[model samples]
Target: MRLLALEASQNSTYYISRYQQVEEFGADLCVLNGEGTEGTWPEDRYRIVGSKHIDDIIAAARAWHAQQPFDGVLTFSEASVTAVAAVAEALGLPTIGFEAARTSRNKLLMRQAHEKGGAAHPDYRFVPELEDALRAGEEWGYPLVLKPTLGAASNFVFRIDSPDEMRERFPQAVDGIKDMAWFTMEADGLDLGPHGLIVESFLDGREFLIEALAWDDEVYLGSIVDRVTVEGDTFDDDVHHAPTSLTPDEVAAVHDVVRTGAWAQGVRRSALHAEVRFHQGRPYLLEIAVRPGGGGLDHMARVSAGYSPIEAVMNVARGVRPEVDHYTPTGVHTAAMCLISRAGRIQEITVPEEVSGSSQLFFFKVTAGPGDVIKRPPHGNNILGFLGATGTSFEDAMSTATELAAQIRVEFTD
Candidate 1:
């Protein structure tokens, strides 16, 4: 089948990784972006690859449509929601609605919808000014999370437990975000995405995930994945167990929450990666990113759970019924651990031979070699790229990966 994929994250690595996944599954893929092309990506993989501007995606889509009559259109999280919807709408093809995309992209709107639907979420308020957040902080309590309404990889998400902390660090946050509404404003209309920010409680407890596949405005089924993080919050190092570590009851509860969230929002034509934390033994909605999750969440589902998120997403765009992984859970833990660097340029990257040689190590791949600068932002910075094994237990895989990662030395330009 042919898949028209949107790859305009403005982050090269994310697009490349996702593009690779789509191409691997025997689907013909096409690329559209906000900014123009990056390096050279083979046309064999992306048969219709180009740096088409936001307005130009349609023409490109039409050309492809006329030539090939694309079977489907696939896109990630919420960023490409509008473009995909517009493209699908233009083509008289099925797509996630503009309103639903808005609900998913903006955290304030998403949480408010949950509350309206009689679901539980942290107390939150969205305001254009910083002072209002401070006022809300007073009304609520300490230990709050302030973040962009539209973002991924937990970018600029901070947890403040005290007024003193807020006073000490609140002002620096007022820079370089262009949020209005997800669909109404584009870079040309008004920078509509992550410019808007919100503050909510730091919902404390163990975090888990539910991956849902939607068919004809219904979340047909879902899978449970457990989150394992080195740092307490996501901004720090984080990992995932493709299969969760929760009990059956817990998985059921989590999956129910996912269903509830999707049903409540009327999600159609997408994959949902939601974060749920237990509050008083019940699932409290952390945040729902209505797209396939980043950081091998897709791969985990493929390798550990026996499904491809990329292929499933393609099916959604094709208007075909999709299959989602079920609650018949797999391992105690099947981990996808990432080894990160604090900061520095890539002088050299060396993986331990023992770890690389192990049979358990399914895929060990690296991005950087020597003389590449490693930036602070972990999302786009490809210092030491990795794709390694799947172990019997999450803890074992994590510990082994961590131990081996220490030996990988990337000498910075510093």
Candidate 2:
């Protein structure tokens, strides 16, 4: 059966390529998110139909649906989740509904549903202006997180330590910074349903990721990744370890939370990625990106834990149950860490092995070059490259990955 994958992620690059490497599935890019992509994909196995508008994406999906009767649709993106759901529903396909997708996009709605569903979470308020957020903050307290109610990649998220900071950031609230599509800005700028930015009581503690693939009305969790991020980089969850740092009880606890969260949000069988933070022993929701975590997260799961997220995703898209073996770790540990390139031109690499080395050693997937727009303290899609490796332990896995990251030797040639 033909599968239409609605992915706008650069993360899917590795997954698509790995699928081709393993000769798994024949897939096509049903739509291009106009996200400009994190990087380019390989030239074979799939076709690209680039269109950023929802009507165009819907049109494309409909055309494909008439030709081959696509079995189902899959997505790893929030920007297009609603669109995909609508398309799939019209085609009489099985996937999460537009209602669930809409609820997932709004932080206010998510919190309310979680609360109504008896899921544990912090208090949050949504407001149209900075004043309401501040008012919510006054009620919540200092050290509250001010972020977009319907945002990904942490575009306008911040923390306020005092009333001064709140006033300083919000000041007067302006919209449309780059003429980046009125619809796009509207979606990012306004929370029509919840009606504004969210002021959530900050729940600080160790955060972990729970990625699951739902099929046959059952949810199968991949890995529980231990997450860390760059000092100010809130977009990407920087550091990741497979097999999770949680004990058995904690894992089970998180599983219940995830299942409840999905059910509460109206998410049916589909691939779901949830970002959760734990305080003292309770799991508090941070933010949920409808897609898989970027930065080669699926790749790291395979390299570190022997699981193929791409295959599982394909199963859901094709209405087939994935053939997944229970993972058994070898003595060797593995990891794939991201490498940030300083703003400069591509001059040379200190380690030549990256250009000509076996997979057992290390791997580099470089995306930036000199003369490119460089920013200090990388976050969000501004990443320069990736570093991956296998070692003997978790610490060793991280260390080796970092060492490989250092060897990446990128000189931004400007």
Candidate 3:
């Protein structure tokens, strides 16, 4: 099979793993990337210059397909999913369609679709201006959340506790929206005109993620991952563990809600990443992305569930249903911790022998070495590295990973 992959960065481990998986499946890969980002992939590279508009991308893809005649068009990156969907549809290939891809990226559209499809979601209002946001705050009450209509990695997401706080932080949130728009415009040439925000009631509950593979409108549950974030901080993710602490019944409940939300967004053949909050024995859909979860989620799934997310995605691209039934629980726990640091130039990184000697330590990687600049939070690229581990139990795995993370400290210059 000849597969056309759009926008796989050479520097990203996730993309590298994906490329390796495709080759492992004995497929020829062709990559399409933005102009300057060309030649990053080792496969047959095609360039789409300024204005990565959907029509332009499709046109370029059509020309490439005419010669090479690719069997599939696929992308794992969130920014390129919509473009891939359009190209796939244009080429008469299987995909989730353009509308579902658009709904997955736009929070406002997603909420509307979920509500219309009978999926429970938080009360939300689209605010085009500051005054509208203030009005929404009043109507939605305090402790609301403000975020961009189209965003990822919790960028520019703020939790407002009161009207006063909302007033004070409204400008910052607007700035975030503008920054996000500028990024999309530069990266994908996607002109997201003006700035808009979504204010929604904060759902107070335990957070969980459901990873699934969808085929023929049937969603197969892969694994339930419990998301651990810094308490009181809206953007900081501490860790993610697979085979969540939730009981079998609770997992089933979350699965039902996730299935509803996935179908509501028209996910037919894709990797589904759905986030839900469990409160008072009820599951509420938070958000859904038509891609696999990042931050070593694929590794977690493989370790705990005996299935590889990357392989599942590759199967989808190859016009085949993923072998979901082959996944069986291994009775082991896996966790991934994000190595974060403050803004500064790294002087040295110290990894203690105790941490390196631990039997539970699966792997440790430091992205920012000595002399590398590390930006603080709220910055788009802030992850210093990642640490992954496995244990007999979730608590043991998380505790060991946390202790190992604490030992490896980055010393910044004065």
Candidate 4:
């Protein structure tokens, strides 16, 4: 299959490895980006649109399609989902459709769709300003989640446990979103839905992440990982373990909720990254992204559940039904976390040979380097990268990952 991936966000370099993996999965891959560093992809297979405007992107893609027709269009970046959908429609390729893509990427639209479809979800209100946020907080009570409608990687997501907290964070989120990388990198002139903050009643229970597929009337949970991060005021730190510790009945419950959410969001056929958290013993849909879960989730899924989300992406992009099943474990235990550090410019990061070459290590990638500024909480949720480890059990894996992570030193300069 010949696939053309769209990434107008200018963050295309981060997914070079994924593009290579797609090629390794037996498909010819070409990338079209709005802006990207040279040498990120093979010159012959990569092109820059040189513009984030939808018209310019479509024109470039159309010209490329004429030279050699692409079988499908796809993207792993959240910021490019809508653009990919547009290109796919323009080129007469398989797609989840523009409306579905838009709703899935915008939290407010997703919530409205879910509500209309009667899917279980948190109470939410779009807060376009501080006054609206204060009003929402007054109505929802304390401990509400404040987040951007078009956010990824947990930027500016906060938990407001009191009026003072809400007052303090409201402006930060409002101003911070104006310059957020995810929002800024989006294609120009696209109807991106509401560009504001949403206050959602917090889900006070265990959370789980799934790499799923929705085909026709059926939605398959290909891989399920538990979000085992400890409770906190801000939703920055991410820690996960797989296969999930949920009972069979609970797993089934999650699947049902996710199915409702997919159909609700108008996602009939697509690769999904669904998040559900329990509230009062019932699962509530957090989100159903049109892409797979981020970080080392792909690795966790492959090692623990024997499911390949990347392969699913490839199959689904061409209007083919990916081979997926209900969540089942391969008995491999693994733990992964986002490596966090103090806010400053990174001078150096040192990883010992023992940690780098450990048998228990399954995945390790450092995203930050010299001169890269790391922003922690309140400012931004920047990270060093991701690290995942495998062992006989969850505890063993967590221990190995945490211990090794501590040994890797990071020097920061203000």
Best candidate (score: TM-score): 4
lDDT of 3 at 132: 82
Residue 305 C-alpha lDDT in model 1:
62
lDDT of 3 at 251: 75
For candidate 4, lDDT tens digit of each residue in 21-85? 89999999999998767777889999987788998999999999999999999898999999999
Preferred candidate (lDDT higher): 1 or 4: 4
| C-alpha lDDT (0 to 100) for residue 264 of candidate 3 | 88
**Worst lDDT window (10 residues) for model 2?**
173-182
Best by lDDT: 4
lDDT of 1 by residue, 236-297 (tens): 43566657667878776776676677656667557777788887788888766667766666
Candidate 1 TM-score to native: 0.86
Error of 1 at 72 (Å): 1.2
Q: Residue by residue across 1-414, what tens digits does model 3's lDDT show?
A: 888887522233346556666778777877776433545567345454444666666777788888878888887777667767777898887778878887877788888889999888899988877788789877777788888877776767778887787777777767665666324632353333323788888888889876787777567778778887755636556688877778878777877778788888877788887889876668899898988876677777777887677777777876888778523577888888889878888899898888777778665656667877765434443567778899878788888888789888778895
lDDT, candidate 1, at 320: 74
Error of 3 at 178 (Å): 1.7
Residue 145 displacement in candidate 4 (angstroms):
0.8
Off by over 4 Å in 1: 44-53, 176-194, 217-221, 230-234, 352-358, 362-388
Candidate 2 lDDT, 273-355, residue by residue in tens: 77888877798776554556655666666665566676666666666777654333333455666665554445654556653
Q: Runs in model 2 with CA error above 4 Å?
A: 7-51, 171-196, 229-236, 324-332, 341-351, 355-363, 375-381, 412-414
Name the regions of candidate 3 deviating beyond 4 angstroms: 8-14, 36-39, 43-51, 181-195, 326-328, 345-381, 407-414
Q: What range of 10 consecutive residues in model 4 has the weakest lDDT sum?
A: 8-17
- Better model by TM-score: candidate 2 vs candidate 4: 4
Per-model TM values vs. the true structure? 0.86, 0.81, 0.88, 0.98
